[model samples]
Target: MGSSGRRQSRRAVVVATVTPLASILGSGLLIIVPVLERTLGALAVFGAVAICAVAWLIGTVIRHNVLVVEPLKGAGSLDRATLLLGRIADATIVVAYIISVALYLRIMAQYLVRFFASSAPDFLEPLIACVAVALIVALGILRGFRGLERLDRVSVVAVLLLTFVLGAVLLFHDGSSLVGGDLTMPPVPRMNPLEILLVLGGIVITVQGFETVRYLGDQYDAVARVRASRVAQIISAFIYIGFVAVATPVMGLGTPAGADSTLLDITTRIAPWLALPLVLSAVLSQFSAAIADTAAADGNLRGLSRWFHGPRPYLISGAAAIAIAATVPTFTIVAVASRAFAAYYAIEAVIAMRTSNGFARKSFYAVLALLLVAIALFALPAS
Candidate 1:
C-alpha cells in the first residue's frame, strides 16, 4: 500500500475505535472521580485501576468471541444451544444499551440544569433528559443517525483533549501543593470489603462500551473490529487510571448530594476558567453516548426480531429511557445498567467457552463467566 493508503487504513481504525472509545468514556469520565473518591479515598486510584483491569479482561473475552465464535456463527456452524445463548446475549445487550441511554441523558441533564441553576428542582433534570431523548428519537426516525453519528468523533476528540488538559493541570496543582507542604488527601467513608467489591462491580458500566465493537462487523472486517476493541480498551484504561489518580486527592472530602456533577465542582475549584469547557464536554460526551447506545439498541433489536424493524426500536428505547430517567435515581440507574451489561458479558463468555478450543482457554472463559454472573447478581449502587 502507498503512504496515503496506509494513512487511510490508520484513519479507518481510529474512526472505528472512536465509537467504543467515546461510549466508554462518555459517562464514566464524568462520574468516576466522585464515586471512587467517596468509596476508596486514598485508594481511589487503585480502585480505578482494578475496575479498568476487570474491563480489560472482559474486553479480552469479547475479542476472543469476535475472532472465534463470530466466524462459527457467521458460517452457520453453531449448535442450537450456542445460537440460543447468542440470541439471549443480543437481547441482554439491548436492555443494557437502553439503561445506559437513560444513565447518560440523566447525567447530562444534571450538568445542564446545574450549570444554569444550581438549585433547580429535582424534576427538572429528568424533564430535560426526557426531552433530549424525544429529540434524539425523533431525529433517528425522521433522518436516521448519519449526521448525529458525527458527534461520536467530535465528542470523543473534545473529551480526550479536555481530559488530558484537566489531568495535567491537576497534577501541576498537586505538585505545587506538595512542594508547599499543603497537599492533603480527601477523607472517605470506610466500607466493608464486601461493600467495596459490590461498589466496584456496580461500576462495570463505567467501562462497559467496548462491546460496541462486536456489533460493528458490517462496517469493518473482524480483524479491524477486534484490533479497534483492544486499542480502545487500552487507551481508555490509561485515561481512566491517570485521570482518577490526579483528581482523587483533590476531590471533595465526602460524597456530595449530587454525584453526577462532582467533576464540575473539582474543576471549578482547580481551574474556574475550565468549568464551562468541562460542562460543554460533559454535555457533548453524554449526548453522544446516548445517541450511540440508542442506535446500538435499535440495531440489536432489529437483529433479534423482525418486529423491531425501522423506527420501532428507537421509539421503544426512547420510551424506556424516559421512564427510567423519571423513576430511577441516577446511582441506581448506574447499578442496574452495570448489572445488565454484566449479564450480557456473562452470556458472551459462555458462548466463548463453548466455541473456543483448548482446556486452558475454556477454563478461563468459564471462570470469567462466573465472575461476571456474580457481578450481575451482586453489584450495588454507590451512595
Candidate 2:
C-alpha cells in the first residue's frame, strides 16, 4: 500500500476501535447501570455485561472472517423480494443507530443542564446537544473518514482515562456516605441464568456500534479489523466492569429524581469534584458515537442508491436522524433501537450460517439461537 493508503487504513482501525467506546461509555455504562440495578438487580447486570463481552467477541470474529457480507450486496444475485428485505434490514440498522445516538445525546444534555446550568431551559440542553452532533456529523461529511478518526482518537482516550479515574476514586473513597461499608472490598451481586438472559438482551446498546465495520468496505483487511475489534471490546469490557463495580456498591445512593443519569447521581454523592469531568466525557463520547453512526448510515445509504452516493448524503441522513430524535420520546427511541438490533442480528446470523464452514457454521448457529432468546427476553418489560 502507498503512504496515503496506509494512513487511511490506520484511521479506519482507530475509528473502528474507538467509535463504539463512546456509546459503551455514555448511556450504556453510565445511564443504564443504575436502571439495570434497580430493575434486574446488580447480579443480572454484571452477568449480562460479561455475556455481552464474550458474545460480541465471538460474533464479531465470525462476522468479520466468514460472514463478512454487507446486507445490501449481491443485489443482482438475489431475487427481488430477498434484495428488498436486505435493503430494508440495512436501512433499519442505520435508522436504529441514529435513534440510539439521539437518545444518548438527550440523556447527556440532561446531565449537562443539571450539573452545569440549572437555570437553562429544558429544551435548550437537548437543542445544544443536537447542534453539536449536527456539527460533528457535518465535519465527518466534509473532511471524510480521516477527520472523524482524529476527533474520535482524542475523545475516546479522554473519556476512558476520566472514567477509569472516576471509578478508582469511588473504589478507594473513605467517606461513609459514598462507601457505605467496609473499604477493603465492595459487595458483589450473584447472578442467575434467567437474569443473565435478560442482560444479554439489554446489552445491545453497548455492543451495537461495533458492527459498523461491515460498511467500511476494504479499508482494513479482515484480520486487522478483527484484531482491532477484540482490542476495542476488551477495553470496553474493562470500562464497563470498572463502572459497574463502582456504581453497584452505591446503588442505594438516591436516584437523580426525574432524569436517568445514574452515574452522574453517584458521582455527585461520592466525589462532587469529578462531576464536571464526567459530564464533559459523557458529552464528548456522545458526539463521537453520533458521528460514527451517521457516517455508517451515510455509507449504507450510498450502497443502495445513486441519489445517496455523495458527501451531502451524510448530512441529510444525520439531519433526518436528529430531527426524528428530537421529536420522539426517549423510551420510544430505546424500543426502536433494541428491536432493530435483534432483527439485524437475526439477519446476520442467517447470512453467516450460509457462508461459514463446519465448526464455524455450528458456532454461528449456536450464537444465532442465543440471539433469538436474547431478543425475546429483551422485549419484555422490566419486572
Candidate 3:
C-alpha cells in the first residue's frame, strides 16, 4: 500500500477505536478515582491496575470471539451448544447495555445538576436522566445515530486530552509536594479480602466498553474490529493506571464522599480552574456513551427478536433505563451493570472454549470464564 493508503487505514482503525475507547472512559473516567479511593485508599492504584488487567483479559476473549466464533457462525459450523450460548450472550449484552445506558445518563445527570446547583435535590438527577433517555429514543426513532456517532470522535478526543492534562497536573502537584517534604499518603481503608474482592468485581463496569467492538462487525471487518478492541483496551489501561497513581496521593487532602461527583470535588481542591472543563468532558463522554449503548441495545434487540423491529427496541430500552435511573442508586446501578456485562463475558469465554482448538487456549478460557462467573454472582455495590 502507498503512504496515503496506509494513513487512511490507520485513520480508520483509530476511528473504530474511538467507539470503544470513548465508552470505556465515559463514566468510568469520572467515577473510578472516587470509587478506588473509597475502597482501596492508599492502595488505590493497585486496585486500578487490577481492574484494568481483568478488563484487558476480557477484551482478549472478545477479540478471540471476533476472530473465531464469528467465522464459525458465519459458516454455519457452530455446534448447538455454542449457538445456544451465543444467543444467551446476545441477550445478556442487551441487558448490560440497558443498565449501562441508565448508568451513563445517571452519572451525566449528576454532573450536570451538581455543576449548576451543588445542592440540587436528589430527584432532579433522575429526572434529567429520564429526559435525556427520552431524547435519545426520539432521535433513534426518527433517525439513527449516524450523525450523532460523529460526536464519538470529538468527545473521545476531548476526554483523552482533558484526562491526560488532569493527570499531568496532579503528577506535578504530587511531585512538588514531595520535593517540599509535604507529600502524604491517603488514609487506608480497612476491608477484609472478601470485601475488597467484591468491590473490585463491582467496579468492572468502569472498564466495560471494550465489548462495544464485538457489535461493530457491520461497520468494520473482523480484523479491524479485533485490532481496534485490543488497541482501545491497551490505551485505556494505561490511562486508568496513570490517572489513579497520580491522583491517589492527593486523595489525602479530603475524604471521598462516594458520590458520582466525587472526582469533581477532588479536582476542585487541586485544580479549581480545570473543574469546568472536566465537567464538560464528563457531560460529553457520558452522553455520547449513552447514545452508543442505546443504539447498540436497540440493534441487539432487533437481532434477537422479529417483534423488536424499528423503534420498538429503542422505546423499550429507554423506558427500562428511565425506570432504573429513577429507582436504583448510582453505585448499585454500577454493580448491576458490571454483573450483567460479566455474565456476557463469561458466556463469550465459553463460546471461545467450545470453538477454539488448542487445549491451552481452552483451559485459559475456562479459567477466565470461572472468574467472570464469580464476578457475576458476587459483585456488590461499594458502600
Candidate 4:
C-alpha cells in the first residue's frame, strides 16, 4: 500500500480499535467505581490506581520501544520473545474483562437477591461469563481480527449512545437530592489508601486493550499499530477515570443498586425507558469484550511459546479459553467464568511484567504470585 493509503488504513484501524476499547473500559469503570467507593474506600483505591498506572506504563513503553511486536509469534518458536511484547496488550484485555465480568455478575446478583431471595445464586454469574469466554475463544480461533474489530466498533456505538442517554436521565433525576448519599450509606463509612490500590488494580484491568493492535501487527503497518495501541490505551484510561468520576458521586458507594451502574440507575430514575436499553447494551458489551479478551489469550499463548522452546504451544494458546467455556458452558453460567476471567487477568498482568523486565524483576513476579492468590480468594466460586 502507498503511504497515503496506509495512513488512511491506519486511521481506520485506530477508529475501529479505540472506540470499542474505550466503550469496554467505560463499562468496566462503572463496576470498579462502586467497588472502590464501598469495598476498598476512596483513599485505598488510589493504591490500585498507582499500581495500574506504573504497570501499564512499563508494559506500554516496552511494547512501543524495546520490542518488535509480532502478532503471530509462534511462526518459529525461538526468534520471537520479540513476540512476547504482545503480552502487554493481552494482559490489558484479559484483566479488564475479568474484572468487569465479575462486577457485572456481582451487581446483577445483588439485584436478583432483593427480588427473589430463594432463587438467586451468587456463583451463577461468573459461570455465565466463563461460557461467554468459551464462545469467544472458539470464534477467535476461527475468525480474523477484522471480525472482532467490527464487533467492537458496533458494540461501542450502541453502548455509548445507550449509556449516555440513560445515564443522563438517572443522574438528573437522582443525584440532585441532598439526602442522596446518606440514603444508602452507613453513618461512618471511610476511605483508606491501601484498599484504593486494590481498586486501582481492578480498574487497570478495565483500560487494557493494547494487545489488539499487536495481533494486527502484520496486517496493518507496524508504526500505525504501535501508535494506535498507545493512543487507544490513553483514551481508554481517560474514559475509565471520567466514568468513575461522573458515576461515584451520583451512585454512592454503599449501595449495590448504583454500583454496577451508578450512572445507569440515576438515569433510570429520570428516564426509566433508558433502563432496558442500558442493561441490554451493557450485557452485549460485556459479552463482546469477553470474546475479544479470550481471543487475546489465544494470541498471547501463541506469542509466549516462542521463548519457552515448547514446540509452538498451539493447544496451550487455546486451553484457558476452552477450559473456561467448558466449565461455564453458556450465558446461564456466570460466576465461575467471571472469577476465572479475573484470575486470568491478574496472572496475565504479572506475567507480562515479569517477561518484559529483566530477571531483576523476578521479585515482582513473587509479588504477583501473592496477588494471584488474593484474587483467587476474593473471586472464589462461593465468594
Which residue pairs clash within candidate 1?
none
**For candidate 2, what's the RMSD?**
5.2
Give the runs in model 4 whose Cα sits over 4 Å from its true position.
1-10, 19-27, 40-52, 65-149, 170-188, 252-271, 299-383
- Better model by TM-score: candidate 2 vs candidate 4: 2
Name the 10 consecutive residues with the lowest summed lDDT in model 3. Answer: 252-261
Residues 57-160 of candidate 1: C-alpha lDDT, one tens digit per residue: 99988998899888898899999999999999999999998999999999998888877788988899899889999999998999888867688889999999
lDDT of 4 by residue, 44-140 (tens): 2343355346445534533533243132233453234434433454554444444343344334333333333435565554455445544544555
lDDT of 3 by residue, 327-374 (tens): 998889999999999999999999988888889999999999999999
> For model 3, what is the alpha-carbon lDDT of residue 234?
90
Backbone clash pairs for candidate 2 read none
lDDT of 2 by residue, 213-325 (tens): 45544666665566556666677776676667666655652333422335787788778899898888777777666766676777777877788766667667667667855
Candidates 3 and 4, the one with greater lDDT: 3
TM-score of candidate 3 against the unseen true structure: 0.96
> How would you order the candidates by lDDT, starting with the best?
1, 3, 2, 4
Clashes, model 3: 0
Span of ten consecutive residues with least summed lDDT in model 4: 329-338
Q: How many clashing residue pairs are found in candidate 2?
A: 0
Q: Quote the lDDT for 64 in model 3.
A: 90
Q: Which stretches of candidate 3 lie over 4 Å from their true place?
A: 1-8, 252-261
Question: lDDT of candidate 3 vs native?
Answer: 0.88
